[model samples]
Target: MRIRTAGVVAVLGLALAASGCGDNSKDEPAAKDSPKAASGKLVIWADDKRAAALKPFGEKFGQENGVTVEVQAVSKDLQTNFVTASQQGSGPDVVVGAHDWIGNLVQNGAIDPVQLAAEQKSAFNETAVKAVTFNGQVYGVPYATENIALIRNTELAPEAPKTIEDLVASGKKLKAEKKASEILCLQSGQNGDAYHIYPLYTSAGGYLFGTAANGDYDPKDLGVGKPESIAAFQKIAKLGEKGDGALKRSITGENSIATFTGKKCAYLVSGPWAIADAKKAGIKYDISPVPGFAGGKEAQPFVGVQSFYVAAKGKNKALAQEFVTNYVTKPDLAVALYNAEPRPPALTAAFDQVKGTDPDLAKFSEAGKNGQVLPAIPAMAAIWDPFGKAEAAVIGGADPTKTVTAAGKTISGQIK
Candidate 1:
């Protein structure tokens, strides 16, 4: 979950990128049409990563329902496009996307609540179901989950760093020995990465939003500028170039993979997405929870679940609901999706099938054992810009207290 929303513009950045694609109208359906227009058809939009895996399942569902089922890859701006298409009544009947889209999709009236039987819901990871629920309504069927963890070059460090200070000390030694060029591979280029830095902030007692009575995130309780947040960043600032030189804005997402793969860094704070590249680079790595500061709490990453949702505006409402809550919830389908991307599956059966088979997967789950469910509230849309900029300033040698305080005010004002 670390840096999951890095560099996002509003809540529209990298976090939702997995929801699907399309940059312009040429790619988007120009007019919304009811799924009713094609009375016997069903469609699902997904990011390219899941399209191939879903095609066979779509064929099976179509065969059973006697309706055509197409799993389309929207590869660009899935969240915005789906809603845009929905307003015009032309969106797909179903969409495979990130759970956090629930709030925005509901706000746009693009999705309907999914009715999962208690027995069926009981088969999923509790955190996953919670991620797709909004205001007490289950809006999506979760299939897979992901969160960032510490991917360390074992040959270099051999053991996981006990604390943030220890990690920095080890990194500095590696740099001094000319064994690496960078201290760490956690990206912070320019705007800074709030997602990646969240654990540190939290370990220092910072929080993004307060919890509502029902355990949902309350945007009204903005914490970006609170005293704890400032103290957290002050600690982070001490690790930057002017201080320990453990972090730098130059290590961006675009370069992080290469930095770690090239042996330019000993540890990379990243998600499962980088595993393949590390293998290709032949780097012997280990996965563990990202360590926290010495005096802080245990590090916690943000938990994100990828899910399937039914479009409220679709013509095949009944069939769409049937596909999402019934068909997509199966353990086999969940495992297939996991095989395609290697993220931990959300289905309890599927998770049990894979956990013992892959130590890496188990490690990620362990790392996020007490992670924050990436808040799905609409107010998250207003937090990215100001908070990210403030983090950038602090990392670049600015005052943590002033920068974090100003960011909190900006977020509160925007929420109001």
Candidate 2:
């Protein structure tokens, strides 16, 4: 449950490294000509965290299908290694990863579109399905979802704020009364986190990319330089250093959860991943949707999905499809995965089974019902650094207009 923002470099660097692996030849039939289900064995790759959880299921599936199943833990550089190995025709039949990797994996010819029945697709959360869909094709079978919401200390702030303005007012009062040392525990750091700050940014009327006719992000219609974005920054500047001082470069991913759990802040904009620390600290807390600016759009966090993709160059294509499309969709498997890593389950039946006992899942899912799926387009690789720097600079008292405009220009030039 590491912060997604901190791993941007490693993820993007791996993607860059993948470009040097040379594209898979469209004419080559190495994998396509392989013995489909006749291989008598199926291999799956997963990170260390989930590999153990998958082993028993793999064994069961293998026994049922009359084949040997292996779930290998490719902990280091899983995605990068998957791609490189895939290109050499020696990768696993299935690989587990984030939905955001769909575009790069598809572009590299490392994974294939998953075929799920219409009823099967309807069994999962709509947002989860959308996150795994790229260019009208579903590339993965989603299992769990994560999104940031407003986690408030109930002892410090008994009621949820109706708007960002109300939250700020309450935070200021808490600071004045010496109940808290910070306003909001949204992580900014020296290098700003677009992920943590995104809900507020959207509420202030900013967007990353405009939607195309297909309802997918249109890289050509960059939103950063537009008029609405500038207007959004004008609102954001009011929450920066010279203003209400809620957002700060001093607060970071490393400390924001700790600050909240330590009762140093009343409100924390974070995901379910932070719940463990809060519980360990023995704090009375409640979760809610991040409030919007009084008159602006509803706050929308990016919905990230964890999924299983069938590798295109797999040795056992039929077995891979069977495991991913059928076995992984079971409620028991989804619940088991959730137990291993406590994110909300993407499967509706599994979530229903668990929500009665764990009400927090319902709250987090409610907060993200309107959230946009984290865009998986390859152009998104160009966004992180410039955009984060501009945000960090603005929060540190730099001119919002000049800084944001420059960032937009730099990003546009980099999006190929």
Candidate 3:
């Protein structure tokens, strides 16, 4: 899929600033509403794409609710701007973003919990809704859900492969015959994409953290270095018999979408974002389940939930809540948003509404039915750097068990 360059750059900047040093102590307390304060205006911070799609809706909501809705398109640094603005007592009343940002946002005390009506709660995928729920409180109203699925060039592989062995064998033959460049292409940048790689790990009976009695992730049970995880990595490392090693992030070049659409790869682990470009390239493609590894369970990727969150500190909490709960939650708007971006809908009605028209989305929805939500706990922040390095080491020919074990230990130690 085509990368939203501006969004990526903005998110990267926020991620960098959030990951590095920051003045947490300087954050201002959330403004408390006095009994007399007016609540006639609501400000919203949204990405350019979402802003363009939702601006009219926002205006309509404002008119219906007798409130002025100010929708600002903040291309990047959402978390940074939200945090900094909240601290300065000048931030939007609501923001649209991924659930993964919960930990950082909560740490900065930049957002508040959202209380959904029973009917509203029932409308969303339970797992998607739960991703934004932290420490026993719901924090966001989910709009969409996304997950990685195994995508193959339909013309090359008319039928989907059922197992890892089947994929490997077919990919090998195609490469040998000069019909394809690589068997599969997965993301492997400076920080290996744990989110994207989760399917392989789960296919081998591996997980990043264990679940508690309540089904929330248990921070103490970090599983990055488990034997199963190692085995999964080992299998992935063996895929592209390139003497060099498993896929490297640097080799992926500037655009991964180009790599797949260019017909250099037969199978790619991607999401809806790539569908538009694949259509542009005139490549016949379809999605399928990720292959299971070593006789383990089916591969399940991390399901990412995108939602709207009202800042606890927002100047227009009442108006923001009314817009989200009353207007944005409707099936029509949800369908519109899903159509614009083409990801599975978190809203159940929206899912049923758009499934027939968008085959790619249907494929993703089916593939992710058994998927797990990526961990949103604060400890998860520690997994990226060291875990990626260990995966790199294994791909670089280091001992699988040792590399993963060391990485796991380092990750466990780093988490507070």
RMSDs, each prediction? 9.6, 8.5, 8.9
**Higher-lDDT candidate among 1 and 3?**
1
Best by TM-score: 1
Stretches > 4 Å off in candidate 3: 1-39, 240-253
State how far residue 275 of model 2 sits from its true place (Å).
0.7
Ranking by lDDT: 2, 1, 3
RMSD in angstroms between candidate 2 and the native structure over all alpha carbons = 8.5
User: For residues 205-224, could you state the per-residue lDDT of candidate 3 as single tens digits?
Assistant: 77789999998899998887
Against the reference, the lDDT scores of all candidates come to 0.82, 0.85, 0.74
Clash pairs (backbone) in predicted model 2: none
Candidate 3 local Cα displacement, residue 122, angstroms:
0.9
Worst 10 residues of 3 by lDDT: 8-17
What is the Å distance of residue 231 in model 3 from its true position?
3.3
Model 1: per-residue lDDT, tens digit, 157-223?
Answer: 9999989999999999999999999999888889888888887778878889999899999987888
Off by over 4 Å in 2: 1-38
TM-scores of all candidate predictions against the true structure: 0.90, 0.90, 0.87
